[model samples]
Target: MRREIGKRILINSPENENAIEVHNLHKSFRLPTERSWGLKQAIFNRLRGIKGYKDQKVLKGLNFTVKQGEFLGIVGRNGSGKSTLLKILAGIYYPEKDSTIIVNGNLVPFIELGVGFNPELTGRENVYLNGALLGFSNKEMDEMYDDIWKFAELEKFQDQKLKNYSSGMLVRLAFSIAIRAKGDILVLDEVLAVGDAAFQQKCNNYFASLKEKKQTIILVTHSMENVRRFCDRAIMIEDGKIAAEGDPSEVAEKYMSLFK
Candidate 1:
């Protein structure tokens, strides 16, 4: 079965008021059916009139809009399509036919934070590598190099190989670099917490600053506290559909009621 892909366009017009707009969005994945592993099994299943795969709908007919500088939070239970929706907005996945997504300006997806990091490289070397991936020139990276290490609190380990750093240290470094990204919209997926308690507090404060500055952000998080604290508006997805939307507190309460 062939799946049709929808359109996603990016336009950088200052006159455009919305940072993101989605309409009738849908996404589905074909999962192999039981006992349909290899070519032989697939041919046998086809001969037996078995489709050999099941369609799993992750998002269905979602409609929403995010105004410029609005902080929108998406919340849902496991497998409820929150990540799928974010991936679509981030251009990592295409939506079904008839679905439409419009991004008004450059979008930086935090989901791609550690994409270009090389474990064999030193922390400083990896920083430059990752910065290049984020569109920073060598001189630009040098200008902010010290600040990046200071924020990640990994200055002492600058010359240390990334392979030698702890898991938490890697996350901190990636996160520090990611925040320096310049874009009109930021899409984040559960990346608010990194490192120890003190570091988390620092991250929290940084988010607060972004919020104070009215930066456009699309956050997908399981933390209700974060939703209430940072989100100007929120949406909760349930079973591949929008279950609730509007005020952050109200949506958070609706999301919490799911367990009850």
Candidate 2:
């Protein structure tokens, strides 16, 4: 009887549940021209023309699913909604119309580098600020502070104001802190291009470690090499919609073909 029940369960098994599910997602932006402060200019411009302002459709009915432990790369040209999609997934932007984004895990987004950092604040202060934004308590940040500073190699300049630091330094500090914040899902834009070669190598090593741990990663980049090396699967977005989705190499090839 047990064997028969097991067989029946196997037969009725459902498809694997995905870690991230996006169904019919849509987003748009309205570019409205404000009325001029001067009444004469506003009246003149309105009388002359301006029939209808156009709304830009940034994302249109996008649908895809990402499974646990999958490294998914998004490849697209500029203005193709790559950043927008990442933002939506990161909960930074709401879709314009009817849409659903179901994410079933902790998420860490390395989208805006040094965004929460205040120029007047010291590096140490900024570190705490960014940590809090990432949902790390002060005690947790204190526990990881030494490691973060070591990885960022900014111990010497920790007391220095952020405005005094170079762009490379800022990127290093921000990237290090963001990566150390634990999350089941990691989202990265093209921020890897900001650092020098040595730092880039370190980032690659870090990503390799994450891959070994089977962390789910969604990376948006134009570098085909990164897509081929880091991603198990790739998706190409064209004109706010999915154009192709499959093996990283194959999708990359198809994406490149569009330019030719």
Give candidate 2's error at residue 250 in angstroms. Answer: 0.9
lDDT for 41 in candidate 1 is 88
Candidate 2 global Cα RMSD: 9.6
Residue pairs clashing, model 1: none
Best by TM-score: 1
lDDT of 1 at 227: 99
Clashes of each: 0, 0
Model 2 over residues 50-126: C-alpha lDDT tens digits? 62334788998888998988999999999999999998888887765458777767778878777689999999999
**Candidate 2 local distance difference test against the native:** 0.84
Give the root-mean-square deviation of each candidate in angstroms. 1.8, 9.6
* Overall lDDT per candidate, in order of appearance: 0.91, 0.84
Please state the error at residue 189 of candidate 2 in Å.
Answer: 1.0
lDDT of 1 at 121: 92
